[model samples]
Target chain A: MKTTPLAALHESLGARMLPFAGWEMPIQYQGIVAEHKAVRESVGIFDISHMGQFYASGNSVADWLNSLLTNDTGKLGDGEGQYTLLLNEKGGVIDDMIIYRISADEFFLVVNAARIDEDWAWFQKHCPADITLRNESDHFAGVAVQGPKAKAAWKAVFPDCDLPEKNGILEKDDWVVCRTGYTGEDGFEFFSPADQIETWFQNFLDAGAQPCGLGARDSLRLEKCFPLNGSDLNESNTPLEAGLGFFVKLDKGCDFTGSDVLQKQKSKGLKQKLVALKATGKGPPPRGGYDIALPGGEIIGQLTSGGQSPVLACGIGMAYVPIELADLGTEIEVVVRDRRYPLEVVKKPFV
Target chain B: MNVPDHLKYTESHEWIDGSEVVTVGISDHAQEELTDVVYLELPEIGRTVKKGEAIAVIESVKAANDIYAPVSGEIVEINEPLGEAPEPVNNDPFGDGWMFKIKTSNASEIDELLNADAYRQLIS
Candidate 1:
């Protein structure tokens, strides 16, 4: 049970604590559905301190990173970030990350909490002599202030420091702010020294931001069809299979790790794809690992992430099925607790 | 944490009223803990179940919860509307949120359940 820098603050607020990614993170404060609705309609703040942070700098840092990650670092301007993936030799996703070009010769990466050690280890094993890599996961705490009013919340806290534009990063003394979030809302991620994160979290709350938890965060992202690294993505699945091929650049003028396999998969046609599913009839909400079957009860795959959408008031989820059965409007049944429920394959961004 | 004096409770958080044919529902403390009640499944009207057996299920936004049989009995009726909209489970767990009614096979089994005071202490 690793604790975040603001563990005590979460406890004081009557948050339901749960173990996630090896951290005793808050599952909810007021309630998951209430907190979820708060983020969709208003502003909500979340503790994202458990995620990993890394800094890389070198003479040809852009080229070096392009050789290691799926997205081309050359495409990023200074202070710009893009969604990207790190892949193993077989094109299986190691982790999905947001890599930013801090400057011409430097870059910063934010990665999943559970993959911190593994991502850091992968970077170390492939480090070229020219590049300097630093794992700063233990030194920083992060918060995501999200929703339509996110900018107002940010303005209330750091009025002197202008918030960056979308997918942009701005760094100050011992702190960094990025216009990024998984909730599909207007938001920014604030990363500061671990000791000062509590103060910053409180400031946002004082500015009328609702303090949310991981439960709401999961539902919010799922509603938007954001693929969680360990759930929709895995060691055996490629980003291409997860419908994240937009981030993998095969024609970036240089080949990177797992690029060859991705090129092959692209040319030969994909075998499976991650697609969204919605319950067609009323029943229990679809959840992860629930079997997805044809109308006749032939199992094809299982849901990777799912829950009832608070906004839509219907069961929604994502699943990886064979490409043949992954088209929009494909009829599927999700077996929940030994009984099949009517489900339909649908388009993403379910909200 | 509201435990009505007339209702009997189980450690699993179900509440029962009546002696022969009882109305069963989840406790307030239970519903409060399992917030955001989304959807639920009720056992068939004629299904017989044993005491402490998981006979029904409730799904919240976070996870699914099993609703157990308070005593060995046959289910006489189910709250079917909950299968569509489950907000009542969180809003009014004891009244409209009542899950089912059972015809007790053994009346003596009801005596072993907790009273309002004991249920309160169990949650606290």
Candidate 2:
């Protein structure tokens, strides 16, 4: 298994290590709930170095990217980043990513950890010969500093560096700092050389940022209703059905992969939609493969990801349900073992 | 991890104290591993349970674990406050976080369980 540059530091901090996306990574430092609360109330740092990074540079980079991704890359100004999806011919999402426009001809992409090889192969197949596509997944490390006090924490570490605005990217030396995160908080993701990542992580810790891990990361993202790549999204599912249509550009003037299918689905509407479900009564928290049913016990769907929401203090999860049953406030049941617990379809970002 | 000297423990991480109506709860080591207890499902009063049978369900932030009965008995009472708030199981697993009381006259069964030193060795 791959280990991040800061794996030693994580061990020194007594983090519980677990295997994630082919990497041996820390799952929690103190505990998931405590680290989760630190991110919500103060500041927390996550070593996300396991994720994939790539650089695309060429004269026709914007035009090529616009045709390759679901979002309109032509709309991204320099120093801007947009959440986009890479889809297959059938409009099924291959991976979701944040594409940063560094300059007129240079763009940086961050893809999911497990999909790096697949995404690389896909890019190579369609990329123009003149375009320079470099996969820098092994050379760099990434860390996310998140929470209400994230800006203050950053200021303490890099006093002279100005934090970027929301969805903005700032290039400094070999690092690319972006104002984006999976957790619903004011935070920044720093991409730096692997050798210097430990120093940066330590500096953030000295600045009062709690060291967190993947366990907290999952809970925090789920609370914000952010769809995970493998759990809530896959090649078998489209962005529209996953409730991520806002990021898909149907009429961007370029026919990117899956555009036609997505356009048709948008116009005709969807048969099933991903909806957030909150446990209404105290019971075992819904988990993946748990059955979603009506009060009469007819199964409709299954949870993609489910767990106890540390902030909400109750069980929360996401599941794909029929369009009619996806409405907010709709009552449902989640079957755990032989018993069914009352659940309700509600809006996202349960926190 | 705290393991009360007077309490009898099971290899599965449960503790039983008192004689006739024994108070039962998970050990501190078990609570530490299952961080941040969120919800629990307690067995109903008057429910008859066999030794080693799962009598309760505990849900932490990441996963859920079953709590087994330390010995055969009828459940006399359950910690009602845990239904609304389960943090005590993480905060005070030995005291305020006691799960249920089982009415059993089987002193020999209790003696068969591990003592504090034996339980500590099992966990280590």
Candidate 3:
């Protein structure tokens, strides 16, 4: 398995390591719940170095991205980033990504770790020859500093560097700091040279940022209703069905991939929708592949992600259900291990 | 790591420490492995359970695990406090975090359980 630059540091800190997206990554350090609480209450740092990064630079970069991504890349100014999705010809999601507009001609993209190779291949097949597409996944390392105290933690570590505004990217020589995160908090993601990542991680730790892991990352993101690439999204699912229509630009006037399908889907309502659920009674926490049913026990769908919310102190999850059952306060049942758990469709950000 | 010398252990990582109405709980090593116990489904009181049968379910943030009965017995009482707050199971597995008490006629089964030294070796 592939190891991040900070693999040794995680091992030295006694982090429980596991295989994720072909990389041996830390699943937890102190504990998943404790690490999760740290991020929600104070500051926590995550080694997200295994994610993929790419550089696209050319005179036609904006137009190229505008045609490839579902979001309006043409509107992005320098130092601005947008959450976008790469869609296939059928409007199915290829991958969800963050596009950072560094300059008029230079842009950067951070994509899911597991889809790096596929995303790179897709870019190569469609990118114009004038646009220089370089996969820098091996050379860069990323660490997300997240929580209410994230800015203060970063200031302590990098006193002279200015923190970027929300969805903004600040480039300082070799380092790129972006005000973005999966956890719904005011945080920054730092991308640096691979070799210097461990030093940066140590500096953050010394500055009082608790070290978190993938387990906490999952819980934090799920609490915010952020979709996981493999579970909540796949090649067969579209952004519209995933409740991510906000990221799709159907009327951008550019003939981009999946525009026709999304435009049609927008006009006609969706058949099914991803909705957030909260357990209404005491039961086992729901998990992926668990059956979703009506009160009468008729199966409706399956959960994409589910767990006990550390912050909410209740079971929370997301599942795809019929459009009629997607309304808030709609009662449902989640079958976990042959037993049914009562749940209600509620709003997002369970915390 | 905290295997009390007075307690007996099972290969599945449960610990028992009593004569007739024995107190049962998971070992420190088991709790450490299942960090941050979030929810638990304990067997009902007076439920008859056979040895090696799954009598409870313990959930952590990442996954769920089945907790087995170490000996054939009837559950006399369960840890009521655990249903509301299970962190003690991770914090003090050998002390106030006992899961339940089983009234059993098979006192000879206690002798079959591993001692502290043997349990430590099994984990190590």
Candidate 4:
């Protein structure tokens, strides 16, 4: 299995190791709940080096990106980024990504770790001869330092460098910093050369950032209602149905890969909707594949992503249910083992 | 790693003490491996089971692990407090963390369990 540069460090710190998306990664350090609370209360650092990075540059790079991604690239000024989706011809999400316009003719795209190979192949297959796209997945190591204390920690490490505003990117010789993160907290993501990432990680640790793992990362992101690709998102569901229509600009005046299907779906209507669910009573944490039901106890669907909310002290999850039953405050039930528990359709960001 | 000298262990990491009314709990190694004990689903008292039957569940933050019956018998008691506060499983797996007490139907099953030394080697 592939391992990150901090494998030895994680072992030394006695982190619980698990296999995720074919990578041997640290699932938790001190503990999942503790690390999660650290990120919520103070500062925490996570190794996101496994995610794929691509640099695209050309005289017409903006137009090329606009032709493929769902978000409108024409609105992105230099140093700005936005959450976007790459869709198939059927309007199904292939992979969600963040593309940052580095310059008028250059952009940097960060894709999901599990979708690296497929995304690279898709980009290469669609690239124009004049446009240059370079895959830099293995060249960089990523660290996301997040929490209320994140700005103070970043200041401690780079006293002279001013942090970019929200959704902003900053480029240096060996490091690229972005004011973005999965957790709904104030933070910045720093990407540096693979060999030099350890130094940055250690520096963040010294600046009082607790080392977190995938477990806490998932919990934090779930609390914020961020859809995880390959789980809450897949190639079968359109962005409009997944409650991500904000990222899909149908009125951009340009056609993307799935623009036609998206237009038709908008004109028609969504049959299913992705909505958040929270357990109303005590029970075992609702997990993925647990069956969900309607108000009358008719089984409808299975949860795509579910877990115990370390902050909320209950089970929370997301699932695609019939549009009529997706309204907030709709009473529902999620079956754990053989018994069902009270579940309610809730607003995004369960916290 | 802390395999108590007096406790007999099962291959699944549970520890049983006393032959007639045995107190059962997970080993220290098991709790350490399952960090952040968040929630637990305990079996009802008076439930009778056979050897190796899964009777309860222990949930960490991310996953659920089953707690099996080492020897078939009737469950006379359970760690009811764990429903609200499960950290004792991680803090004191052998003492305050005991899951249940089973009144064994066959005392011979006790001899089939591994001794402290043998259980230590299984984990090692």
| Each candidate: chain B TM-score | 0.98, 0.97, 0.97, 0.98
Q: To one decimal place, how large is model 3's interface RMSD in Å?
A: 1.3
TM-score per candidate, in order?
A: 0.98, 0.94, 0.95, 0.97
**Model 4: lDDT of residue A292:** 92
Q: Per-model i-RMS in Å?
A: 0.9, 1.3, 1.3, 1.1
Return whichever of 1 and 3 wins on lDDT.
1
Model 3 scores a TM of 0.95
Compute DockQ for each candidate against the true complex: 0.89, 0.71, 0.72, 0.76
Off by over 4 Å in 4: none
Model 3 per-residue lDDT at A321: 85
A246-301, model 4: which lDDT tens digit per residue?
Answer: 99998887899999999999999999999999999888899988999875568999
Could you give the fnat of all candidates in order? 1.00, 0.87, 0.78, 0.70
Ten-residue segment with the worst summed lDDT in candidate 2 chain A? A280-289
| Candidate 3 structure quality by residue, lDDT tens digits, B1-124 | 7889999999999999888988999999999999878888889999998889999999998999999988888999999999878879998999878999999868888889899999999999
- Highest DockQ against the true fold, candidate: 1
Off by over 4 Å in 2: B19-21, B103-108
Candidate 1: residue A294 lDDT (0-100): 87
* Candidates ranked by DockQ: 1, 4, 3, 2
Clashing pairs in 4: none
What Cα-based lDDT does every candidate model obtain? 0.92, 0.91, 0.91, 0.92
Which 10-residue window of candidate 4 chain A scores lowest in summed lDDT?
A: A289-298
